[model samples]
Target: MKNKVLLLTWSALITVVLLASLSFARQGTGLIGNVFSDFNDFSWQLDEFYDIVGPTKLNSIDVEEAKKNITVSDDEIERHRYRYGTLADQLSNIHDQYAQRIADAKDAGNELLMNTLIEERDMKLADIRKNFESDAHVEAKIRKEKEKALVQYLNDVKANSFSLPVAYEFTDVETGETYSSGDVSVPAVYKKQFNAAKGYFKANSLPGHNGTNGWIRTSDYGNQAASEDIQITTSVKTFEGTVIVPKSAVAKGGVLYSQYKDFNKGRLATYVFWLLGIIALITLLTVMKFQKEWVTGTAIADWYADLKIDLKAAAFFMTALILVGYIDSKSSNLSNFFTYQSLGRWGEWLTSFLIGGVVMTTLFAFQLVNGVERWKREGVLAKDIKNSFTLQFFKALREMFLKRSIGVQSFILLIGFFLAGIGFIGGFIDGIFLMIYAFCVLFLGLPALYIFVRRSAYLNRIIVATEQMASGRLNEDIKIEGRSPLADHAKNLNNLREGVRISMTEQAKSERLKTELITNVSHDLRTPLTSIITYTDLLKDENITSEERAKYVDILDKKSQRLKTLIEDLFEVSKMASGNLELNKQRVDLTQLLQQALAEHANQISESGLDFRTTIPEEMLIAHVDGQRWWRVLDNLIVNAVKYSLPGTRVYVTLRKVGDSAEFVVKNITKFELSENVDELFERFKRADTSRHTDGSGLGLAIAQSIVDMHQGNMKIELDGDLFKVTVTVPTK
Candidate 1:
């Protein structure tokens, strides 16, 4: 508690000192103009004061006296006469002006108006001709106009000279007489102490009439009449009295003056420096203490960290705004020192700065303690931004743009929809707009209607196709046109139709296989059982020799064993079909396994009069499989090859690595034609010997296929006329 109190006290004190320094820098009169003694000066202030007071001695010109001396030359008079252009062009201009008006009036049957316009044109032309013929009359007319213009110019000059509250005393150097305007008794403080004359003057030359030629020349008459020219040269007057402004003029209403006064006379600069020095020392001590205690132990830091993410973010944003506004306000106030304006409220500015400084320091400390830690504990800045509502809205809007086809189509349709609606309404508003409605219908509405009809027809076709597929007719595929949503749906329906067709075909094949399985099982199992029964009945006939009885007993024994073998094979095959067969798997050399299978069938291969050709890689090809199950697969293929190969034909058994898998292939010419579907050879109780005369269960290939499937291996049978081939592939370790 003590540490917390001490830290807060020290921090608040630091904030106050910092804010005071900022305020001093920002306030125009506080630092640059007042506290900074080197920059403080009074000369500029005196100059500005004199400007406010304005010039004292005013000059006037006598236009009548000056005009009497203005003489117009004959050449100048001639020039002025034709100033409007040649007489012929002048008459033409007048005619051009009234010709259109006169014709329009005549066309309207207003003869009086037309005659009036013709008379005006004729009078203007007559004046132009008269000026062209007479020179003296033109010269007199030009002189009168020059006199009138000079009088107006002088009158304007006098009207524009502003009267001031200033007093002036002028003494004539020759007469020793004094002329005064106002009181002419200003004090020494407000006097404009300057060596130069400060007043308006009259000249023999006219204002802006100095040129000898061109339209800008107001008059050259003064240049010609040199003798009568009354040149009013500037005269010097000796002024004895000092000009002064009353103290009221430089009071509160005149902020610049007051500020200058404070700038010159105020002596608080040393005190301000000492205060800042002391504050700096205190800040150093405070910083040293803070380095030891930091903000982690502060209750405020804890409270800030405990705030909800949104509330904390708002606090951070508002703090930033306040700091920015405070800095901008201070910077603008500081700039005002160089400008001539009212000084800001120093006390109010200081107070606001202090408050803002405290808030800034508090939030900065809190941010140091909690902000980075919180972000690391929660999520990164990207995650936070991605979760923001504004970003999410923009992300969704970006996705809308990313789907360009849909967005473009939707945008075009929306425009067409609105345009068509507007056109429909416009048709009722005006007859001319009826064309717009028709144009929109032909260009926008008709195309949209056609697309809708086409899509609807396509949808109807899809529906019909689906109905046909439901009724088990899946031959036809729905036609897909464009990359539209409807087309995608149609594609999906096509795939579903293919899937359904395959499912139905598999169902029919399963039914036929089930019937064949029952028939084959009945024939194979009953044959052995019947032979055993017949031999047993023969042994039961006692009227026979011992040798005959023994032979009969041997026959019964052989038939019973065959029956047992058939039943065992049937149970094993059934177990494999039901997916209940378990195998002990291990890494076995497939080359060696194949060699062992072929070696076991060597006797049969030789007895069948078939040449057995074995090909295997010398290097070990290892595979992860159940040793006994894999051996069974190999044994079945070799046995079938030896049994079914045509007499004196070559049976090829090859084992080699193909990429990442081991391929064991067996090819031979079958002794019998495999006219049926080659896929049906893997069925139980089905074999190349259609007569069921071979002393073997027909479950060899079916069991082999089941075992290969369980081990995630592949077994394929290919038949070409009398040629039979089997390929078994399995992944090698």
Candidate 2:
């Protein structure tokens, strides 16, 4: 609250004071006064006075009214006194001259002459005393003298004014050479008339003398009067302002001009005041709002965080400042400075530099603070930077310069700007651009070039890696470098290479498994066929015993049955894998199916010497699937558990609803040690036992997994220690 009041008070004080100053200036006698006085003109001051006190005040200042309060200046009084004193002396001289003339007449020894001379001398002396003794008489005398001068001046003007332009000539005292009539020189008194006479010579070809004295005719005048010279004479008149008008009126003209000058200045000051008042109000309101944090945090603030200060920008700013200062320092040309007794141009430069330096330093301090704050705040929320300018610089260098593409283009464009700068600007600007070019080449160029070249090298590696992969050699890993796009591409390429290698490895494994499957099936089928063939051959032999014949027939039937089952299992597994098996999907109780399968496998479980550990939930776990296929899945899992569980080892079968899915898990300890390669057990002719000893076909788990997949269920196998666990999850909805 106090601070707010203080701000308002300060603002009010400043505004009031400035307003007062502004009013004073606008009255046209403050700032304007100083400016006018610089040129020795106080006209604006008079203007201010007249504007304040209008023509009414001027009209009020009558001569009689002015005389009542006005005192004459010393120069005027002294001049008038000298004039009065000289008149008194002139009166005394007149007296003395009259007395001398009186004495001369008296000395002629004629009574009449002496009386007449004495009378004339007395009359003239009295007249002189009367004229010189009183100011009125003196003023009248001056008026008469002016009247005489005016008349004489008019007469001279009349004499100089020719009826028509006529040639005139004058003799040259030094050279008596005949000269062109207009070319002849004259006294300053007759120069005007002489110039007027020039048109006559130029207008007419004839030279002759006119009837007027010294007026020569142009017709034959130059030829006939070649040796003749005419004399030139005239009187010239000059006048003063005081002679044509009252001293007061002439002074008033000056006053009026001054008034107008003040009016213009007042207009200018008015504009300044209006702008100042507006700015003051805005500043106050802005400050109040800013103090309240009304608009503190914004996009600009965030952008400020990304702002960075550049030394080159500062240097350019200073360079511009120096140029402006130089221009200002040279405000007065060298010639003027020297001729007008001012400071030397160098001295002016020094002074202006100091002043400009002070102003620029203040501005620079503000800018530097802002720049530093921005630089500091840029990485405030960021990592890999420790809030030091140096750290930030290096970070930027690593990210923008050393890395590649994204920032390398900026460097390229910057170089291009300078390279193209010569076309846009010439002279000093071109030179400066050249300097920038050299600077960039020396500093930024080497690093940028390295980045680009390194980027190119990475690209080449990627290309080569791609070509190798295209040619079926995809085992190589592409080297990853910077965090640039090219590096990302390299990483992707490396992943692709690994993927391709895995794919190719899988392909080779599949081929090997395919060969093994063919070989194993051939051997298994041939063993049964060979038995059948031998039995049939034995049956064909009539010499064999009856029991032997019966045994051969049973053997043939058993081998045929085994061959048919294996072929059927293979076809079912193939159909399931090829996605050709369709399901009559419906919501089925997974728990019930699991229990039923467990019950059916109970006899096998009992015979196999494997204990059953069942945890089938009664809460009715349901799954959307083919009820028959789901039963088969349970039957297969149970059968496999019964077959694979070691004697006295428990097989766990659990059915539960987890979230929206039904999970059925079967876990067992294998009777035959389960191979680590459990996935191969799902392939045809592959089993835990590499030797064809297990009676069950290897397609049991494979068909179950395929049925689960057809129902959009997940089947997972986990092997831990001597335990194998298979989990199947089917969606309920």
Candidate 3:
């Protein structure tokens, strides 16, 4: 506890000292800049006094000297002659300038102003007509007008008092013209000590004159001219001047130089002291003990970090406002510290407010440092804002807008309620109005309430159906009633339920196939083994004849060959099922391959007592497939037909181009019933010879389908009672 207290104290001390240092640097001089700038406030006051007084003093002499050269030039007369253009243009300009004013005066019942404006327009028009073409007349008029304006300017300057606590003397360098005012004999030592004014001549002392002189045109024309209606030229006079600040003026204490000297004392020393104090405090705070305890994070930091982002931002804004107040007060005080100026009643209140603000800002600064350290260790502002309620609410709004129907409906409902609230506000006027509002609510609100309740119940139904589906009860589907959003949701739920049903059925079928697979494999292997074992026992009896031994041995050899064929076929089918079988695919003429398969089985087809009806295409139907695998496919289909077809029944083999595919179809009347599902015939070890009388391994169709599928083609079986058909379709291109 003691460490935390000391840490906070040291932190607050550092904040106060640092802020004070900044305030002084800003209001006085900067840390590494001119030390004399600490007295800039007094310097500014001195400069302001000189600026306001110097121009007034200089203008009097400048105007007096300029009035001597108030002569009009030929160019000035010509410009003034064409100032308003032709006679017609002059009349139009006059009308445009005063037409509205005259109308306004007449409307306001000011007949004097109306008549005066009319007279003035007439005078200007008459002047333009009389002097429009006479250059000499215009020049005479311009000179008279300039002299008249110069007299008026001199009179105005005389009326205004431009008193100063100094004396000035000027002498023209080229003409030796003297212009002096007040005491010109003041001591030269006092002039040098005070730096009262520049003694050298400035080229451009008059307004609007650079280093050259020109005719001073009036503002009526767009030339930059003299001010105050004083029409005169600068006349190119260079004057050397000296302003003398007397010791009497300096001793008076209210003059600018006196005020500056009085106020400038101890300003630099104050700044240096403040800078050293801040540096010392910074060093002390840096090496302070237990800094990690409170400078890292404290209870206040935890409280701030736990605040909502909006609240934290608001606190930071308030802290900023307080910091601004502190800086303003500190600067205001430091800038006037030596001036001894009082702000009257407001100053006390402001000082108290600023003290409180300073304390608050210092504490905020301490907490801000600690909070920043804590936030860096945890995460930045993005992490906090991500978990903020404002972001979450906006995220929800964004998701709602993804489905525009729901968003629009929700907005409409909100607007309806908001307008309804406004309508209810009128119910406060009278009790009868309240009763009317109640009736209106019942009339409109009932139907809306019914819709809300119905949708809620429908949503509940969908939820219940999803729950049942999750628990593996997919028999029931959601009942869709309307075309609303809720109804659409119910339809999707029903579709999902159907998909789950199909998946469950396929799973059961797979289980059944697995069981049948084991049974068939065991029976098939055991029968061959039994035959081999029985025949071997007969051969072992030496009493048997050679013909009997040879016959038993032949039986054994046939059984072993059957077992080997079964094992090999099983392994190949397994490889195909597990996707481990690789095919060597190439472009081959499928028509020739089909004919070759039939040629290979020609003897079997002839001996089976089956009538073979072949419809092989003479043209080549090319396809990309593994030739060896594709031949196996055709061989299996043909062999199956020959083995299973009833005696003397006709077998059909057809190969033709069908659309984008090359289709090979074989049809036969089966000796046994194909009552099983057509799709189940594609399962391994499943055959039409359920009694196990034939040597058929039941993998023929399965292997054919796997090979076709590997080539990105199709194999399908169609059964019509005892008539079975198998079709293989592969892409021709």
Higher-scoring candidate on TM-score, 1 or 2: 1
541-637 per-residue lDDT for model 3 (tens digits): 9999999988998999999999999999999998998999998879899988888888888898889999999998878889888999999999999
Name the best candidate (by lDDT): 3
TM per candidate comes to 0.37, 0.36, 0.38
Of candidate 1, the 10-residue stretch with the lowest lDDT total is 207-216
Q: Per-model C-alpha lDDT, please?
A: 0.68, 0.57, 0.71
Task: State each model's C-alpha RMSD to the native.
Answer: 21.5, 32.1, 26.9
- Across 497-581, the per-residue lDDT of candidate 1 in tens digits comes to 8799779889998999899889999999899888888888888888988999888888888878888878988888889878788
Candidate 3: residue 409 Cα off by (Å): 13
Give the CA lDDT, 0 to 100, for residue 431 in model 3: 82
Best by TM-score: 3
TM-score, candidate 2, is: 0.36
Model 3, residue 593: C-alpha shift (Å) = 88
RMSD of candidate 1 to true structure, Å: 21.5
Backbone N/Cα/C clashes per model = 1, 8, 0
What's model 1's overall lDDT?
0.68
